[model samples]
Target chain A: MKKAVPLYIGTAALCMVGFAYTLYQIFYVAPLAQAPLYYNQKIFYYHVPCAFMLFAAVITCGIASIKYLRKREERWDDVAFAAAEVAVMFGLIVLVTGVLWAKPAWDKWWVWDARLTSALLLWMTMLAYMLVRKYGGAGAERLAAGLGIFAMINIPLVYASTRLWKTNHPSANTVPSLDSSMRAALWLSVLLFTFFFILLLRLRIDAQRAERRLYRCREMALDAGLFE
Target chain B: MDFLQHVKTLAWKDIRVEFRSREIVYTMTFFAGMVVLLFSFAFLRESSAANGGMITDASLSPGFIWVAVLFSGTLGLSRTFDRERETGTMRGLLLSPMPRAAIFLGKAVGIFVMVLVVQAVVLPLVALFFDAPLFDHPLALLCLTLAGTLGFALVGSVFAAMLLKSGSREVLLPVVLYPILVPLFIAAIKGTATMMSGSMSETWFWIRFLLAYDLIFTVAALWTFEHLVIE
Candidate 1:
């Protein structure tokens, strides 16, 4: 655990640089472009990579869920629960950035377009998973694991709804073609956000594990009549 | 042979119990009916244009109907799972040799059947109250309704199974379910709206969308159901 600290710090440093580059692209080069429409579209570099990180976290939950179900190990459940909480935070970041972008680009604070609504769905699903963990009691680990699995099941439907329906929401076809410089910057943002997501997930899991350890110690002490 | 028998027995047991009480169906129907009534009063003030496609001003008819079903569907989902949890019978079923997905499917099928009946009544009630003339494209309406209901029940069962033993099962299920079901709601509403507005030509397009949605969610629900119910 002591040695692991350095890895996390390194990852954080890398992510901070990526975040800086993402901000630069969105605020700088994006504005210098010939068209104003592309101005807000630059938010996509930050917005989409954050969305991908959220997907990665959710998929991690699914994997942890399967492991928990197969093995009934408390450790797997800890990872699943922790990953889910962080996923929700990243999801909110995505929602906020998208809203910021939408407000300037589309002249509306929000739109029921498929992608936006889908992100909302994912947010709610993550929130529900966290709530189940928080309020559902001792038996909740199994249940939370189950809900994680079910919620992940909804992701693709959320992603594909726009292409399937002819709605006011802009379709994927509307995504602007990216120049070479923009493409390079966007990929770097994705790579950097991925590192940040991993670092946060590890820190959360450590916190959860420590809490569980303390809980078990208290339980065992009570069983031995230590307090009495 | 044993697994088949187990599946049949569990499904039949749920049906028999539901028959004895009718609690789930009654609550879902009344709630669904009342929602349509409330929306009609608030949104349409009078029944003058109720005979035609009148409330076409806003995204009225399908929007209101889908909202009602989504809410009531959650109500139905919790009732089904709470029944198993309260009685402690679900553990016995889980310990049985029957596949877990079978148990999930049993619940899914039961909820779908009950909600379908509710929608059957609710759709006509909307047509009569809002005067939207829904029956003109009965086939398309039926397809969208079935797809939407199945997706709801399928995903809902996975959730119910997930939440059955937990304390906040009732509140937890819908909070998780509604957001996920948005696509289904949109597809069903759009497809149904087109059908009702007599846009029969383009109706095929939206119907396919609903069908695709139904297929995607059904498979996802199936893959995940085992993990949810196995414990």
Candidate 2:
């Protein structure tokens, strides 16, 4: 715990600096080429990174879920639970920022476009994962692990079907070549978000571990004739 | 016993019990018919009253038919394990020497047969009520229905078993099942729509998609069913 403090502080500091720089670049350095939608596209830097973070968290949850199922280790379950919580948070940010970007660019807050629709579906799956974890009694962890694994497998199918069905969203190559400075800013934002994600994931897992330990300790005390 | 024999025995047992009781089929078929009736009243009545061609059209019938099947299929899927639980046979089955995958496959096949029976009745009723030209491409429609229903049952059976002990099995099954089956649903809808329109060009793509979905989930459920069912 003592050794982890400086690393946490360093990531927190780096994230703050990177965030400020991203804002500065978005407002001043990047060219406002797409008139009227200039500010809207600015959400892209934050939105895309959040989207990436969401995927990262989900993948982590899936991997951790697999580990939990294999070993039945409470640590893996904690990690899976933490990663799912973070994934839901990042998913919410992606959806909200997606809407913010959409309202300005598409003249509407929502469209059944493939990417957006898949994201909504992904969000719903994560929500369902959490619900099962919460309400699935006795063997809830195992059930949730199964759900996490299923959700991971479904993601690719979701992407494929959405692409096959219809695609009103921008195609893969539609993003024009970014200016060098814009590219640097985007990479920096991604890096910072990655660090932030790791930091939060570690913190959440630690908290959950502590909570489990406390529960076990309480059970032991009750068994030992402590006060009710 | 051989694995195939085990699976068949379990499946046949479920079928015989269901046949003797006649509970699941009657309820599932009735429920499916009611859903179709409700759709006819809501959409068909309103559209015909307004002289709109939407509800009478072939394109919309695919969606209506699948919706009915999906809802009623959920009814049967949730009930798949209830008999085992209520009779305390679930524990006995778990203790049996049969491979867990056989248990899963058997239950899935049982549900698949049940759903097919319900669809057999419901599809004709849909044709009768909505005037859907279901016979235009009968073979294609049959293949699509089989693929779709198989995928649905395979996924639904595992989840139903997992949630058998949960208090809110009915509500939770659909909530968890629908989102995962979205791709399958999309493929089925598009495939059925194309077939009903008498177009074969792009129907194969959706059919292949459904096949792929069934392949992936069937293997996945088989692999995971053991872990999901054991205490």
Candidate 3:
């Protein structure tokens, strides 16, 4: 724990530096490709990375949930819980920034376009998973694990159904070519966000482990008649 | 073979209970009818005050029918496990030497049949009230309804079981079920709308989507039901 403090601080510092660099590139380095949408499109740097991190967290949550269900290990549950929490946070950022981007790009604050709708539903599903974890009784962990897996499986179906229903949102498939500098900045922002996501996940898992340990200690103390 | 037979027996048990008591089917059918009635009042007022055209009713009936089915189907799903929980039969069933997935399949089958029955009643009522031409493509409408109801039952049964032991089962069941069901709803509504418009061309896409959704969630629920049901 003592040795890990410096590593944590190092990662935080590096993330701050990367964030600053990303902002700089977004404002000045990346060419203003789309006219009249120049400054507004800058939200893409942060929004896309947040969206990517959200998906990565969801996948991690699902995999950890499967492991916990199979092994019934507290450690796997902690990972799943942490990933879910992180996923919700990133999902919020994605939605907020998405709206900000949408208002400028589409002249509306919200649209029922496939991508946006699916993203909102995904957020709601994650929120439901969190609610079940917090309020579901007795076997909340197992129930939440099931929900986690279910939500993960539903993501593609959500995307597919939305696309089939309508296609108002911009398609990733038809993205015009980005300038070399813009591509570099986008990749850099993604890498930075990935690093930050990992750091936050580790901290969250550690906190969960400590809380569980404290809970077990309390149980042991009670059994030993230390409190009465 | 043994597993399937177990599923059939368990499903029959539910069917028999429902048939004798007539609680789930009656309530589901009534609730679905009420939903359609309410939607008719709302849509009829809006459309009549706007244009008083039959075309508007025809255009809106598909969505309204699905909405009614979804709400009443949720009511039926909650009742599915409530019966077992109320009678304290869930534990006895779990204690039996059958695989837990069989229990999920049985309950899902029961709910599927119940929802279909409710749909059978509600569809004609919706058509009658809205004066919509829903029977233009009977086979297509039936196929879409079956796929949609099966998908709903598949997901709802697993969630109902998972929440069976929770305190806020009624509230949380729909809270958790509805968002995940967005895809199924979209497919069903689109399919129904296309079918109502008398064009079978685009309806196939939504039907295919519904089939894929039903298949995916059926496998998922079966795989996870055992984990969800264990104490």
What DockQ does each candidate score versus the true complex, computed on alpha carbons? Answer: 0.55, 0.70, 0.73
Taking all chains together, each candidate's TM-score versus the true structure is 0.86, 0.95, 0.95
**iRMS (Å) per candidate:** 2.3, 1.1, 1.0
Could you give the interface RMSD of candidate 2 in angstroms?
Answer: 1.1
Candidate 2 regions with alpha-carbon error over 4 angstroms? B45-57
Instruction: Give a tens-digit lDDT track for model 2, residues B133-193.
Output: 7878877888899999999999999899888887777777887898899998888888888
lDDT of 2 at B109: 91
| TM-score for candidate 1, residues paired by index | 0.86
Question: Scoring only chain A, what TM-score does candidate 3 earn?
Answer: 0.95
Tens digit of lDDT per residue, candidate 2, span A19-136? 8888998778877647768767778889888989998998899899888888889999999999999999999999999999888788899988778877888889889988988877
Off by over 4 Å in 3: A173-176, B45-56
Predicted candidate 1 versus true structure: per-residue lDDT over A23-74, tens digit per residue: 8776766434455555667767878888888888898998898789888898
Q: Model 3 chain A, poorest ten-residue lDDT window? A: A167-176
In the range B1-231, model 3's lDDT, one tens digit per residue, is: 999999999989988989998898999899888887777667554444565543336678888888888999999998878888999999999998988989899889999999999999988987888777788888888889999999999999999999999988788888789988989998899898888887798788788889999999999998888888854
